[model samples]
Target: MKSCLVVDDSKVIRKVARHILETLDFSVEEAEDGRQALDRCAAQMPDVVLLDWNMPVMGGMEFLRNLRQQDFDTQPKVVFCTTENDVAHIRAALDAGADEFVMKPFDRETLESKLQIVGVA
Candidate 1:
């Protein structure tokens, strides 16, 4: 089965995202911040990463940069899944190698559609 890593500082967000992914038949894992996400990436090598734009410990942008540089086992397809709806942030995420950008408060359909676009949903 396909696996995913959901990264966010909020416990509620993580739980909800995990439920969404698991419901779609994707195995789910989670991290509270970018630092933990990075570590999880190296260890678990999930097929996709749902990353929050902001966090206390290592922000998502920095994590994206690091992921771009690394030659990891999974080389996960990343999606910017955050509350930030600004154009600049979306552009930055795309330039940083995210396969897709999904705004927060998304429903299962919205998330599925984005993943489908990337051949991962």
Candidate 2:
């Protein structure tokens, strides 16, 4: 099965996202923050990453920029999954290397659409 990594500070968000991805047939792993997400990347790369913004111990925007700077070819397709709705934030994320964006409180169709946008659905 395909795999996905969910990087979020909120346990509830991570759990819910994981459940959704699992139902969609994607094996799921989780990280509580951007730092942990990087650790997951080093250990085993996932096909996609759903990341949160404004997390403690390393935020998603910084992580996205760092990942883009790395030489690794396996950096997962990143989808910024956050409550940040500012246009500037969204623009920065896209510029920083996020493959897509999904806001918080998303329904199943929204999640599926994001995956589809990245050709993972």
Candidate 3:
């Protein structure tokens, strides 16, 4: 099965994402913050990552930069799932190694579409 890491500070968001990803036949894992997400990646890198922007320990952009610096044969496709819908935020995320972007309050369709666009769905 394909694997995915959902990184969000909000428990509700993580739970919702988990449900959607599981239905899509993905082995889902959850991380409350970017630090935990990084640890999870180090232990076992997932095929994709659904990352939130404003995390407590570490933000999504910082985590993306750190993750990109790691030596991986194939880096996980990162999708920034956050409320930062501004063009600059999206562009910065894309330039920081994110494969796609999705806004907050996303439904199943939106999440699935972004994942598909990243070629991980």
Candidate 4:
């Protein structure tokens, strides 16, 4: 099965995302912040990352920048999962190397579609 890392500071959000991804047949891992997520990636990169924008320790943008610079065997497809819906924010994320963006309060269908768009689901 494919793997996914759900990087979010909120326990509830992580739990919800875990359920969705698990139901979709992904092996899920959770991280409370970008730093932790980065460590997890270094150990074993997941097929996709569901990243939140305003995490402590390190934010999503910083993580994306750092992750892009690393020489992983297979680059994980990053999808920013956040409340930030501004065009500029989206543009910045895309420029920073995120493959897709999914706004907060998303349902199973929305998440599934975004994952599929990134070719991870």
Off by more than 4 A, model 4: none
Off by over 4 Å in 3: none
In candidate 2, the residue pairs with backbone N, CA or C atoms under 3 Å apart (3 or more residues apart, or in different chains) clash, namely: none
The sequence of per-residue lDDT tens digits that candidate 4 reaches over residues 1-121 is 9999999999999999999999999999999999999999999999999999998999999999999999988899999999999999999999999999999999999999999999988
lDDT of 1 at 55: 96
Q: Per-residue lDDT of 1-121 in model 2, one digit per residue for the tens?
A: 8789999999999999988998999999999888898888888989999999989999999888877787776778999998899999899999899999999899788999999999888
Candidate 4 backbone collisions, by pair: none
TM-score of 4: 0.99
Against the reference, the lDDT scores of all candidates come to 0.91, 0.90, 0.94, 0.96
lDDT of 3 at 43: 92
Pairs of residues clashing in candidate 1: 115-121
For each candidate in turn, the TM-score is 0.96, 0.96, 0.97, 0.99
Per-residue lDDT of 98 in model 1: 94
Model number with the top TM-score: 4
| Residue range 5-42, candidate 3, lDDT tens digits | 99999999999999999999999999999999999999
Compared with the true structure, the alpha-carbon lDDT of candidate 3 equals: 0.94
Deviation of model 2 at 90, angstroms? 0.7
